[model samples]
Target chain A: MTDRRGTDERLAAWLDGAMNPADAAAFEAEMAGNPALAEQAAAWRANDRQIADALAPLATEPIDPEWLAQMGLAESTAVAPAMPPAANDNPAWWQKRWVPVGGALAAGLALVLLVVGRPPEDPQDGGLSLALDSTPALQQAQLDDGRMIEPVLTARAADGRWCREYRIGDVAGLACREPQGWKVEAEVEAAPATKPDEIQLAGGTDNTGIAAANARLGTADPLGAADEAALIASKWGDR
Target chain B: MADPGPDSQAMREEIIAVLPRLRRFCRGLTGHAENGDDLMQSTVERALGRAELFEAGTRVDAWMFRIARNLHIDAIRSVGRRGTQVDIDEIAETRGEDGRETVENRSDLAAAQRALQALPEEQRSAFLLVVVEGLSYREAAEVLEVPVGTIMSRLARARARIDAVVGRSQGTGND
Candidate 1:
């Protein structure tokens, strides 16, 4: 007996016109002899049409106006319109162009000074300096919601982002701090009486909520006492 | 790191031109309009934030699609980490608009959407890119960053699943 499932794939390909002409002709001849294959092929075609019909309506759905504004295309005009001259008529367009250049130069100079003359108290001085300035060693970060969670581990990811694993009660989570704040990347609730290592290996399975979390947590270099202290002082550098 | 160059402007326009299609793709991906729109909004924010990374003169649609796919994966991973997959079948069945009650009997569209949502994420994305987006298998593979054979395999599986669904529904007089 032919594998109906295997034939289903070929029929799907034939329906998609993805099959080569020679193979298509052979399949057609075979289907002419096999009523079941033909019926299956017909069903698959009907299904494809129905899928197309059903999904075509989605193309007409209205987009949110806010999204348009966010893309800077609310005006629906050419992307870069010519900038009008500044209200002061003293500067010609050519001279007006120099203003942005001067501003950029001043900005670049300021950046250079800031980098070269960083204050000794600057939080980002060095890893050691940051450690020195950090709050006394504590493994907790107070979330904006005023809930406290223990930071189980802190490490610099390969991407150079500092990430942390935190535990709130029995649930553990991973988050990497961005310039804005702590962005929770993943979380898993531990199974009762499960060891941390076991949960780490088991991952984020629905029953245990452990396996997927483990996979996402992956391997990270653990921050030492001083680095963790620095991170805590930096508040994940959100400051 | 948004670039204010003319190329950036042009890319923004290109993205806007594709917004309807992008929204449709999101809706198809997420199984609910609200969730899809939220995902679309997030996609727009990330695209804008990383505009400088966009290569000039490249297909912005493909780039945006890649970004959207990555974000969707991240979101689902986050949800998985939370200990449950989104029950897309239920979400697709009960999803409604504008305070209207969800249809008592699921419509053909809902059924099709549920079927699409039922596929694994990899398969769903493959089907959408090839069938809905009208991309060639190679192009879809490029967008997905997978081998062409992988794209074909994924599309085959996706089609088989949808075909089985529609075929069953038809056999039962539901379609």
Candidate 2:
């Protein structure tokens, strides 16, 4: 949608931050002249600030561990803005079908809660830091939100597709940046990243994507070093 | 979900760092310090329990938020505390790092609390998740278990209501 159309639908998405970079930019540009839209954005900001500030008090309370531990089954209740059930309607169907077909899968699924409580890493530092380059190099990063990203060797298999592994979400995944776009070859079954480094950013919004793409290139140390920040700044770090 | 690693050590380190933000989000939902900690603890426990459920191709915060939302709803329901609410001023008074002595007029803080508490739960959740907690609409919807469109509408409506409340509060004996 061309953001200039001035529809409430697009505006709502923009306010909620569902807009892609291009759309968001266009929407912001229009906000310069659109009084109604500007007012709407202000009110939204105000509302958010007030609520956040107000809710600040009750955030530190501790739940009775004994109570939480004794909790067996969750209470069945309904609330507003309801959506589809996350679980299948027929639990028996799964019991009869996929359960029998994949024994190991069934075992793995059953052990999920107990086996996977621990995180892949502790997220107490800064964030998921990364270095992307036009050349291949070993890069490590902590994300702004505290998720970590690190990379290593890449090689082409018999089929001639370059394959490498990186952490996505909370698990490690084998991915190939093919002509079609990056695709996960295999997924790592592991705990979630408390501070996730993953984002499905539109074309150019990510500070890391440029570096990731650069690393995709066959170069010496594709992710420039700390001084390289100045170098990247000289080229594309205008922001 | 796909973070680059064998960085279990690294990931654990970062999780420790981000706990404060998670605590903040938890605080927003529970409305008091004690409940917020309980909420955070539940959030952490759930995150650990559902670790494998964390997709390798999604945002980490969004995922934690999903766990947090479920836990919050679960706590509210399990305790059978439907629609039994409390005063926002009391929350601030109880939870404020700096007590009432720090405030110019305590009513401003009180007014802010009342305005937020007044919003419908859906709108309140949407506004906090999007504006304060910084989740995108799709992420917030995922947390709230609703469509992105629903999130947007609730947020918009929440904003309108807050503006009205704040405007009214500004005019009254309070500021």
What i-RMS does each candidate reach, in Å?
10.9, 8.6
Candidate 1 lDDT tens digits, A1-239: 24764666577567666788998999999999999888877765676677667776676444555556655666543222123222321211111113232132211211000011112333321122222223233444332112235555666665666765555443445555455344555544332222223222211112122223334445366779887776666666654
Query: What lDDT tens digits, residue by residue, belong to model 2 across residues A1-239?
Result: 33433355566677666788999999899888889889877765665666566544333222232533343111111011123322222111112122322122222221011111122322321322122222232455443333345544444434544444455333443444444334444433333321222222222221122223324433232233444445335532323
Give model 2's docking category: incorrect
Query: Tens digit of lDDT per residue, candidate 1, span B50-108?
Result: 88888876677788888888888888776667654555423342342212222313386
Which pairs clash inside model 1?
Answer: A202-A211, A203-A210, A203-A211, A203-A212, A204-A210, A204-A211, A204-A212, A205-A211
Q: Write the per-residue lDDT of candidate 2 for residues B1-175, one digit (tens) a residue.
A: 6543454334443344445567766655554445656676777677655556666667667777667767766655544454445343233323432222222134544555466556665666677788777787777888888987788777666666777777776678553
DockQ of every predicted complex = 0.17, 0.17
Q: Estimate each model's TM-score.
A: 0.53, 0.45
Q: How big is the positional error of residue A210 in model 1, measured in Å on the Cα after superposition?
A: 69
